[model samples]
Target: MPGSASPHVLLAGVDDATEAVLRTELGGRAAVRRLPSGEAVPPDAADEPTLLVVGADVPAPAGLVSALQTRTRHLAVIVVTGRAGADDTSALSLLAPAERLAYVRADDPDGLARAARSMLDRLALQHAYRTAQAAAQRRLLAGGEVARQPGEQLFGPLYHQVLIGAVAVDAAGRVIAWNRKAADILSLRNDAAGRSFPLLFPPHVRGDLREHLARAALVPSPPTLFERLGDDGAAQTLRMSAQAVTNPDGTTHTLVILEDITSSTETRRQLAERTSHALLSGDVAAAMTAGDPLRQRLQRSAQAVVDRLGVAVARIWTLDAQENTLVLQAAAGPHGHLDGGPSRIRVGDPGVGLIAAERKPHLTNAVTDDRYADDQDWIRREGMAAFAGYPLINDGELMGVMALFSRRPLPETAFESLAGIAGQIAVGISQDRLLDRLRATTEALQRPLLPPDLPTLPGLDIVARYRAQGDSLDIGGDFYDVFPLPDGQWALTLGDVCGKGPTAAAVTGLVRHTLWTAAQQDPDPAHVLPSVHRALLRENSPFCTLVYALLDPSDTPVRLRVTSAGHPAPLLRRRGGRTRLLEEHGPLLGAFRATGHPVQSTVLHPGDSLILYTDGFTEGSGAHLSREPEDLAALLASWTGPSDDRLADRLADLLFTDAVTRWAGRLRDDLALVAISAHP
Candidate 1:
């Protein structure tokens, strides 16, 4: 109803600079009206086909766009903006459906005018189609069978302008008539009239096409099928639907309709691929990071490849450099078993071993037909067709080999994806192997450096927890110790040496032993900390942070002498669940000469607790886990768990769990926490 007359263009907020340009470009093709920014759309504007061009500067442009869309069925909208990236422009662009919306930059007046003219042309086409539909309906109601004609006039203008390809064929499957859309969609050569419809399709599908046409001519509700045409590299998906129609003379013809759905089909396929890649990467990373043996991790990764990629079989092999042989490390799927012969292959052997020898990928879609694989009965039995074998190379060194077998031919694109997946798994395997060695070395060093068990002092309960940075291969230097001193006093120290690896570990040992010896000679932290400071400077070791607390448990409420050197202040949680920081600061040890060591003394009353930790407990990737002192203080005050033997363990667990969650399980530095709670 709206397109029954000439379309109207309503330009709102057209600046003076671009107004004349727009008018000249529009060429008086449509009735144009200039509406000020302050005015609302006219009440009668919705009565005819309308196009609204609103500027981005208009107040509440997104709201206006929504109102215009909902109020009329035949209105198209264009939003002109000074810049594409402006906030208002983005809001207006996304306010309406893409087909009914257009956006043009204000500086490009010609572009805006072109968009307006295009929309107007579309409106005219719709009006013509609607008019023809009404005339056809009228003729049918007036008994038109006696005077009906053939060809374009009989089908009316609507048939020629419609989007889908349409063809009319006789019951014998010979093409009688077809719309222009059919000729273009099918890439017809010369003339299509009097041609056999089935012959136009691929030779392989011609017989099936004939059968489908016959079925459609006989059935009232015909079936539809999707056919792929063109070369393999650039194929298109055509959805074909057929229906039987009777002419005025009672002759029946089968009407074939085709709609190109290549874009939508490719979109669905790409979405599936992305989902698969994400799932595969997650699974492989999870398996590699788990506390499992190398073989078990490899097995999990192999199973994931099979499950995610839909491969019939997947196998992994690791190279034994000593023997120059590749051994089957993991296998999954129907034929995935390592107990059989050829579990070990020499580097120069054929098939999987050859891929490793050359350090290149081997992809084939004719595994069962290849002469080299003809001897394998399983390949024939399983009807295996496609094979992809990639050498797992990391940093130019062959780590192993990964191979998969499939019963169907995989597209060329799939081989590229599989190659990339193999490379990812290779990197994961290499990292996991390195982590194994690091774990062994770190565990050995940690066992002696950190006190296996804190000394149990009278009226004093101490617990400490330590975790190296997440996914780190280097040894950490975070250490904690609780040792006894003369005069019934106890020395508790938590420290983080600068840097990592062997140098840091060496400094950690020196600091621990020096603190123990110093506290024995003098139980005061002020004297003990300075002595360790001198020891670090003498060794020329990296600068370190230390928190040393000398506890005299003989008193009713433990008298604590605490000293901090370039360390995070310790939290003092009172008996009533209130927490505060004991702020004592000193220069970093081993970094400067003549540095003062400051000490603060506090009494830990019965039912009170003291928490000492390294900076890693608070600092992490994002703001959520950033070093916020207030957040840490509040967290300590909210603790409701018991302060018993497991008090320190539970506290460390809570803090570490929260840190891991906020940082996404990837800590950038070593984390250590020590909780000392006085027993009632």
Candidate 2:
């Protein structure tokens, strides 16, 4: 009724004056036109709507109504009568009975207009309803036949093809008659007359079924469910109802109907499980976006697995890079026996090792404990009947392991769910392990060689790693330090002294201490560095190459304002894998009485990487390292570990392990590396 278009209305047997009145009363919404007597509606307008307003005094009014209805059911007829014709029954008797019949008194001023508008409105509503019904049927059946209404012509021959089965049994529990649906569903002969009803029922429900039948004669009641063995020998749920009827001979008889609902019920159950699995997956995905600590995030995910999937002892194990063993990252369960157990499990089978070695998931029954006995004897003693283990592998590298155990076997749907959970665990474990290592390195870098271990600034994960190249007794002249400034920004420095030993070390210390003292007065590179340079000039400290950077991530693309003081240009890798060398260099620190270090500005998009290091990375001096910046950029491109995980490790390996080991001669200068990545 509120659609964009209104139905067409063709009015017949009306004078020009009356037609004008009808159109005005109808609000001019629909196309209202009057047709002359004995003239049929056009072919185009016939199927939409043609309202016939016939007067009882008109000639052959009944014939016109009959002809219009035969063309299409879209026609409706309203017969109006003057006061004289209202008393006559001849015209009414000639008309056929239909749902579209209406009557209005010709003497009434607006009766004909009201009837026409009302009839057209009804026609519009019927069209919309029929269209909606057709759309719903098309969606349900896809491409199947939906030309007519459901259960109309299509269901005429499908009485037996329906999923439900039916049969009739006498009061004595003897099957007297059965439909083909029953025979097909139960897998029996169509003419299974005089067969025993109780014999066909599954063994478990026969007793209750007999009791129901015994009570049927005494009580008039609703249908009761009975478990019956299907053709496949599995129990099927069937509803049975009984009624007692008197025969012509004055004897009483019972009629029973059987309907099966096992498949439909099972379908519902599986759908529920899948929906719950999707919800669990959504929660974990949400946690991935959250800023919670890795282990805490993993703990929440593990608990979700246990709660949604009904598994006991959900746990995550990460592969230790040094020992190559699976170490427990998080565990969730109420069982106390697992306390004080080996947090790091040795890499072997019957547990996590088998999942890794086989390169797939494994479902085992630990109760038997023969071929797959767990290394931990406690697991064997628990008698957990079901155990599911999935290897946490990413990009062909084994990151860790995730597993679950239960006292009872899980449903078939749960296995499908476990596969997806395992993949998520792999990503979680890899990312967390990588971040943990990076954080450890970062904290060591943050504290520097200051007053022992200082509490890192809270609420931000900014950390730095300084790796001095030497044994325990030997300390290198290369150094880096970070401290929080007054206005929520971070101040950091990475520098390399000219040479090693006492003079270089003293210069490094003096440079750092002078910078520290200057930082208190002013932490900006332009403000602080000039004072430190003047003091270093007075002290005549050894020359050191350095870069001072201010880190500010509160903008769309994280901003870094850096001033290069004769150090190597820091490399920035964009999120798309391209690299850039920020070449903004000035005189070495303490080289001039008053130095003007040109400030370089850059932004880091999410997932981008920035690395600052000593020249040792490029001029491998004695080693066969890549001396060209282009070669170094190519090497940086090769170390593509999971960006969110192990990116710092990859940077370390490229600048230290891989490049340093390939030196042409011998190592000379100390190396300092600082790497950071932007989060999405």
Candidate 3:
């Protein structure tokens, strides 16, 4: 039967009148059973009895106390004496264990019945506490989250297994309940149940605890750490965490937990010091090497850590940006194949599991432990009996992780060490990334400077363009200009410098400024070419190419005079759909020591056009025509009288779009175009 079904009583050593009085008082309240003497009580009777009433002063059998202690471990035993002195009470305390004993005056029937009823109530409570504690243990062992209620008793062997050092305090800071572990650590007994929690702690920690408790009560969540002293009088560090217990009526109580973390804290401190030294000395040495040497040095450092710390396996995993996955970098022990091999794990892959999901340290004591048996296959395959892993995070971002696995259970000290080392690794990775970013930024800033909008010219519609070579690291060394000379003539020039990137861009800038100065000094387009070419060759190499032209649209026939310096000849198109190349013969600029080069002149009617371009247009393996010079002539011959901007935009689209499609999105070089159109 259930312990709470009915109140049970075992009666002994009462006179007939007293027995009659007791039965009259408790007959309806209790289920009364009779025992003649302590010797005659049945062995199985202890299970059925809730209270045992014996004569307090009666001389019982020698083995009576021992027998009662054994059989009635769960039963409450009450002693009644006709008349007893203080010494008798003291003797009774020694005779019976406090957990099982209660004393009452036998002459007072009312007092005897009250004592028996109170003992039955306490026994029922203890039974319920054990039951609740058993249920909680099953839940915890099954890996389920279990919540507790305020003032609810927790008692059981299994409860102690999960909760090592547990204590409960109320809002007022009074100790409500403490388990065996807490009591042992605090050197407290049953009398400490209602004492203030502050009195149990050392003087220095008492005020801090009160403030923490008060803050915990005021906050919506909980506080994680609090301090206290140990029973051995040594300074102890305790972690006091609290959960708020709320009732349906909105009343609140705090369920505080005291965890002894003295050993764990000290272990963390020592591990941090060791990790700092290793990172400072070892990482620097490893970073000094190149390629395989660096990787080997890193692996050796990891191996040294495993040897010094007595760990079974250690591994490092790094993030791969190309694949967007984590790949094992280095490893030691039975799973050494993971080192420098591709073991890609996505952010939330099923096989990757909770280690990366939580972004914190994950620890498991045994592979077969009931709490994690559901993942047993993975655990065994990795040869991980005890596992601890921490993320390598820098600036609050996860870079990778360092993990240690053991075929045997790991001590708490090992967990602390691994966590500290993982943090140091994170710092090293952050530093490497920052340096790489700085280099990339410095390289990206060297592109050629180009004006957003070209200057407008009266009676002339001009379109100028510049493009960078796709294969080039920086910008191309191309330059173009369309400016009016001082003598009422429009002068234009296009040139290609020697190289690429910052050096080429610098040469282009120098040539551009020098030609503009030469044009201002001598208004003749023919004179400007030699002067600018001479200035460019002085500071630059002989590998340059240039072209200069002068257009006087005010003349009746619209005269055009042009000169070339190793540049592509200009192409001209007439209104009647005939095109020809204005191939003026001249030596390439900066090539030979030259004196005077002849100038070629031509006249254009209204509605005629000319196209000037860099080699990027004709250098493509596949152009509009198989022959590049013939292709340029054909493209100009087919031109409609479109606006300069419209024709330039369409030209760029046709050239780049066809090139991108044919090359599968690869552009081998830059292309520039300058179109000059005269309106009728």
Q: What are the models' TM-scores?
A: 0.54, 0.41, 0.38
Instruction: Name the lDDT value of residue 577 in candidate 3.
Output: 57
Question: What is the model-wide C-alpha lDDT for candidate 2?
Answer: 0.67
Task: Provide the overall lDDT of each model, using Cα atoms, as 2-decimal numbers.
Answer: 0.76, 0.67, 0.63
Q: Tell me how far the alpha carbon of residue 663 in candidate 2 is from the true structure, in angstroms, after superposition.
A: 51
Predicted structure with the largest lDDT when compared to the true one: 1
> Tens digits of per-residue lDDT for model 3 on 201-299?
778777877777776554322436555656666867777766554433345566566777889987896777566555544553453232343346456
Q: Over the stretch 1-680, how does candidate 2's per-residue lDDT look in tens digits?
A: 53343455666666566667777876556677666556677666654655667765666666676566555546777777763433443554444345567887777648777787788777777777856654554455554543232222222224334565555557778876555566666676644567778888767777877777776554433678777667777878777776554333355656555677778867887888889999989877766556677778778878888888777688877787688677777777765423224687667645565565676777765445433434346655665678777787877778777777887788766877777777776777677666667656534543444334222432222334455443212446777777667777777778887766556666777888887778777778888778767877888777778888887756757778888888888887876668878887788877776488888888777777777788777765644644866666777776665666445446656666755575534555556677766764
Model 1: which residue pairs collide?
A: none
Off by over 4 Å in 2: 1-164, 169-176, 190-199, 207-229, 232-256, 262-270, 287-289, 311-313, 321-324, 328-344, 356-359, 364-369, 374-386, 405-416, 449-680
Q: State in Å the error of residue 528, model 3.
A: 2.2
Best by TM-score: 1
After superposition on all CA atoms, what RMSD does each candidate show versus the true structure? 14.2, 20.8, 25.3
Tens digit of per-residue lDDT, candidate 1, span 1-680: 24347666777776776667766766566677787555555667654677888775776667766666544446778888775333665575455557767878877877887888888877677667866766675575466443222334435456755888888888789888776677667765446668898877778878888888886664422335556575344677777878676555457688888887888989998889778868887888788777788799889988998898788888889988899999998899977442233688788677777788888888888874442242467777777788888899888888899888888897776787777767777887788767778878877876778887777767767778787885445678898988888888778889999988888889999998998888889978667878888999899889889988888888979889888898888988887789999886888788888668777889988778889988887775644647765677788789887766555566667777777776765568788889887885
For every model shown, the clashing-pair count is 0, 6, 1
